[model samples]
Target: MTLSAAGLGSTTQPLSTVYDLAMLDLDGVVYVGRDAVPGAVKALTEARTNGMRLSYVTNNAARTPHEVAEHLRELAMPEVDDGDVVTSAQAVAHLVADAVPTGSPVLLVGGDGLRGPLEERGLRCVTSLADEPVAVVQGFHPDVGWRQLSEASFAIQAGLPWFASNTDLTIPTARGIAPGNGSLVQTIRNATGASPVVAGKPQKALFDETMERVGGRHPLVVGDRLDTDIDGAINAGTDSLAVLTGVSTLQEIIERAPGQRPTFVSADLAGLNESHLEVELDGDRARCGAATAVVRETVVSLETGEPAGTEALRAVVGLAWSVRDRSDASLTVDGTLGA
Candidate 1:
């Protein structure tokens, strides 16, 4: 929604009281491949030290929770327990085990890590559908082949459930980029024209699991991707912080509708802790930083494609105050209106 002065003062609020739990996206938010983002570790540690509960949620299907934890340790991040990490591999396994019969045979087209969760769920993993499998489970398979896709389609066509771990088409890899599970899932779907049940971000199940793991009065989701992380937060009925370290850019944020807009946005995790202090509103954007009072002004048309007016000016200022309240920032308005 377009920012108006009337709504500004009412919306701003201090951020400290706005969120209790922070749901962090691992890949883009914490690091890109093996290199950790600057200040990621410090930001997260500070959040925890400030009494905020933290949990790392990832869409990486290639790594298991234990493996992910070790990777984080190598990056010098705070220690995370096994239960604190969630992955698409784990999500798919949970879905399959809960829905399908125990000990059911399923054709797995993914890596050893993806298969680990399935095995733990008591599902027997097979290489092909030759055994008349009960289902076809797909995740990120770096060595996937056309033969595997054909076999998965065949299994699904035979009345077997087609389950996909996630729909992330492109996964960031050390070697630039690699095809993710979505690419394979689409290939199988194109062959059989079959739609499998997806179990990952942008889905309610993943969000539910995350909230359950990091319980809080209010949880804030932080991520760089719009489709998965942002959508997930919206689905979970929680606020979100869209960082520019990953998929979405500043232009995309400017063009987004209010429903898709994050509660806060920043260059990286570095400025997140300052979100509760002060209120900032410039045109369509709004942000908060820790401070006692904030005031902002911008010139804009009273009507769409029309000239500016005193009414339009007052509207935006009021809107900034409203935003301050939402961010839990304290506010005070003065009569000195700038032209």
Candidate 2:
């Protein structure tokens, strides 16, 4: 569906009550590294109390659901359990089992994250192509190296169906951003000249997997990154909220491509329980609450009245996005988003 003009959806009711499930992306949303995001725990506790189910979804297939759940529990998110976490590993496992026969041997190139799900799907994990595998599946794991990639390449070259948990080129580590499963997949793709059927975000497999297991009628995808999380939401035809506690900045979001735009933008998790202001189109301008944004020629102007801090932000975003989407104009914004 080509979304509404501004690509932003307003809500009169709190999001926590509007949607039955919130498909959340980890690493940037709930916590940064090992510590919980400042008010994440409190906000989530309130969301859960308001009858919203929180499901942690991640493109990182390096960790198992239990491990992920433990980490969330450690961060004092009492609502997160093993059942509440959805990994790309689980998504790929379902894809693999559907193609290859049950109880078949699938060549594994990652670690327990991928292995556990494959086993749960009634498939066996073999390390080498010499083991007579039916298919090959690759994911992100710290221990994967030349040996694993070599085996995966051999299997793919031998005409086995290939699958990947995700193709994210880079992942944020404790040290910094480093090579991710996408980089490794590129290596194999270059060697074998073949692409794996991906099962992560930007593909509906992961979203389908989560909804199938979680049982939610209305699901809202929540994340920090625009390229992956927001794009994934668009691909699945779901509403998305982009939080600012991670890589994506507010200004970048206002200027992003229409396809990558999110349905909502908030500075923190608390916005999950708050009403999202409406952005109404008014000729060559946009208005939200008491704020208004006007685009004349190449410049986009903002007018913020009293008590319209964030509304001013929504105004500019609506104005800028609609202006760009329709006329292909460039708008430069250099001011506070009013948080």
Scored by lDDT, the top model is 2
Name the TM-score of candidate 1.
0.77
- Stretches of candidate 2 off by over 4 Å are 1-5, 282-285, 290-310
Candidate 2 similarity to native, TM-score: 0.91
Model 1, span 1-339: residue lDDT tens? 123332221223323334677788887788888988877988877776777777788777777788888888888777577777778778788889998899998899888778899999999999777886788888876777888888888888888888887888777655666667788889988888889888887776676767665567777788988888888888877777767677765445434444665666566775456532223455334333221223344221222210122122233333444554455443333332221
Q: Relative to the unseen true structure, what is the C-alpha lDDT of residue 159 in candidate 2, on a scale of 0 to 100?
A: 94
- TM-score of each candidate? 0.77, 0.91
Which regions of candidate 1 deviate over 4 angstroms?
1-17, 174-177, 276-339
How far out, in Å, is residue 142 in model 1?
1.9
Q: Give per-candidate clash totals.
A: 49, 0
Error of model 2, residue 66, in angstroms? 0.5
Per-residue lDDT tens digits of candidate 2, residues 1-339?
Answer: 123446777887788999989999987788877888889998899899999999999988988999999999998995677999999999999999999889999999999999999999999999999899999999999899999999999899999999999998877655667888899999999999999999998788899999998889889999888878888999998999888877777778878886678988777787788777778887678887788888777766776542224566667778888888887887776454534
Give each model's whole-structure lDDT.
0.67, 0.85
CA RMSD of all predictions: 8.6, 2.7
Candidate 2 structure lDDT: 0.85
> After superposition on all CA atoms, how large is the RMSD of candidate 1?
8.6
